[model samples]
Target: MRRCNQCIVERMDSPVPLIPQLAAHLVAAGGKRLRPLLTLAAAKLCGYPGTAEGGTRHVALAACVEFIHTATLLHDDVVDESQLRRGLASANAVFGNKASVLVGDFLFARAFQLMTADGSLRVLEILSRASATIAEGEVLQMATQNDLGTSVERYLEVIHGKTAALFEAACRVGAVVAERPQLEEDALAAYGTNLGMAFQLVDDALDYAADQAELGKTVGDDFREGKITLPVLTAYAAGKEEERLFWRRVIEENRQDENDLEQALDLIGSTGAIAATLDQASAYADRAARALAVFPDSPLRRLLADVASYTVSRGR
Candidate 1:
């Protein structure tokens, strides 16, 4: 993690001083760095041999993944008009939206630079496509937001593009760098994709279920934004006519009052939406664990499986 941090600092250096400064501020704000960790772990699992110079290309690539993820966060905060991230004021909130957006672009360019430095078209292709897919997902989400007519399949597609695509790329790149067998590479990709899905599912559920402190931002942030997550979809599906009217007014029409969020919570709870969401998350987590079955028993495998389990457990 420290190596990744230093890599970010080194890469952020630019003639435009504010570019680096703004990028550095959010990078310094702590996160679990789970995506990079997965990259490193996948490389290790594949028994990647360092180059003659005693260098692990995986570390640089892992740092690149972090840069991409952080870049998304910076842009996401601006788009969401989010005030807090990782329990601290968001980059857009503290540094202004313009600066945050520019720095985010800078970080994205830096990520591509790292990908090119690695000198693998495969790595470049995966990361580049993931970046594009993430943007598409964001746009798709905006299109679907507050539209109660959104189907479960469409919601899954959004999460797969926005969240799981990067995870799949991150893990797949590790296997590519290590020149792992195709079966093992596919397994790791499956593991990452499922894990990412579980992680996002829990995150969506937490927006309604968790307190502000535990949630890292305000509770009901999604409700306030009129974002339609799975729990909202589930409850809306199960609602009676009066309850459906309430949802249409609040979510579709965006006619929320002060008491609307409380009422939303009550409806969600009554419909068992939180539990249902978590159950879906758990199913994904299990699939992630099963994806590891291709690998032999090892500490890395155990740790990765535990991470999958921890994804849903965090919601609880």
Candidate 2:
């Protein structure tokens, strides 16, 4: 990631000096770095050779994946009007929305530059398509915001596009760069896709589950933004007449006020929405684990499965 930032700064000569600063701010702020790890793990699992004397191609590609993920986060914070990220003031909050958005674009450009440097059409194709799909997912989520009629399937589609596509691409690139067989490539892709789905599901649930200090953002941030996540969908579906009215007022009408979030949480808990969402997440996690059955038993394979398990439990 240090090298990734160096690459980013070396490429930036825009009129606004803070463009690099704003882009680098969140990157400097640490994250779990799971996507890049997945990429590296996939490469290593597929037998990509790396020695102390010689460099590995996977490092650059892994950095590229991080750049893509960071770009989305910058854009997402602006769109959601978020104030906190990773337990710190968000890029938008610190740099202003305009700066954040522009810097995010800069990051996207940098990511593509890295992709092109790798000199693989397959790598470029996978990452580029993932980028486009992520944008589409965000737009779809925006369109469905606050709509009570948004189907569960539609919600799944949104997460798959917004979150899972990159994971799928990340692992796919690992296989491509490693010259792994197509079957192994497909297996890693399946693992990534399912893991990404489960990751997002738990994230959505955690919006209501954790406090600002714990979650790195304000609790009920999704509620304030009027985004329709699975937990809200489940609760609203199972709610009684009064609970339904509450959802309509708070979500559909965007008429939220003090104590409304608490009421919303109470209703969600009473309806077992959180548990049900976690159950759905667990199903995806199971699929992620099952997808790994094709790979020979190794620490990496076990680690990937452990990641799936950890994701479902993270919100708790």
Candidate 3:
């Protein structure tokens, strides 16, 4: 990870002042680096040498994963008009939307450079496809925003594209770099897909249930944006007629106010939406753990399994 972080910075270096400056703003904010970490772990689990000397390809590819993820964050904030990222002002909020979007492009370019430098056709295919799918997922989400009629299956499709697709690629790349068999690659990809799904489900639930400090953004940003997530979907499904009206007003109509967030929280809690979402996330986490059973029972395997559980239990 240390080398991976260095690679991330090294790739971002440009004489252009604002380019590096805007890029560093979000990257320096210190996210979990979870996607890159997944890459490193998957590589090790697949019997690749450590990220030192003989295993440096994984480092570059891991950094490439982070670049892709960071690019998505930059683009996502602009699309969502989000003000906060990791509890700090978002790049779009601080650097303006144009700069943010262009910088996001810069990061995407850097990711491609890393992928090409590695010179693996399969790795290039996996990551590039995931990049396109991420954009599609976000667009899919845009289509579903504020529409209560969006089905659970559609919601899964969105997350699978937007969130889990990269996770799957990150893990698959680990095996690819290690030159693991197709069986090992598939196992790790399955682990990553389930973990990413659980991760996003928990994030959506936390938007209603967690404090600002814990959440790293406004508690009701999704609701304020009229973005329909699993929690709102659950509440909207189970709510009474009047409660449904409130959801329609705040979510569908986009007529939210200060107190509306509090009310939304109450409705979500009353309907057990948060709990239900967490339960669903837990189910995915269990699937993620089971996906790793094909690997030998080692410390890395156990830690990765624990990470799956931790993804759902994040707020508390």
**Strongest candidate by lDDT:** 3
Among residues 3 or more apart in sequence or in different chains, the pairs in candidate 1 whose N, CA or C atoms overlap within 3 Å are none
Query: Worst lDDT window (10 residues) for model 2?
Result: 1-10
Per-model TM-score, in order, reads 0.97, 0.95, 0.98
lDDT of each: 0.90, 0.88, 0.92
lDDT of 3 at 45: 94
Off by over 4 Å in 1: 50-53
Q: What is the C-alpha RMSD of each candidate to the true structure, in Å?
A: 1.4, 1.9, 0.9
Ranking by lDDT: 3, 1, 2
Q: Write the per-residue lDDT of candidate 3 for residues 125-168, one digit (tens) a residue.
A: 99999999999999999999989999999999999999999999
Arranged by TM-score, best first: 3, 1, 2
Q: TM-score of the candidate numbered 1? A: 0.97
* Candidate 2 lDDT tens digits, 1-316: 4544455446544667797677567757768888988887888888886534364678788888888988899999999999989988899999899888888888788789889999999999999999999999999999999999999999999999999999999988888988988999999999999999999999999998877787888788999989999999999999888889999998899999999999989888888888999999999999999998988999988998999999999876
Q: Can you give the lDDT of residue 109 in candidate 3?
A: 96
Error at 311, model 3, angstroms: 0.6
Candidate 3: global Cα-lDDT?
A: 0.92
Local error of candidate 1 at 282, Å?
Answer: 0.6
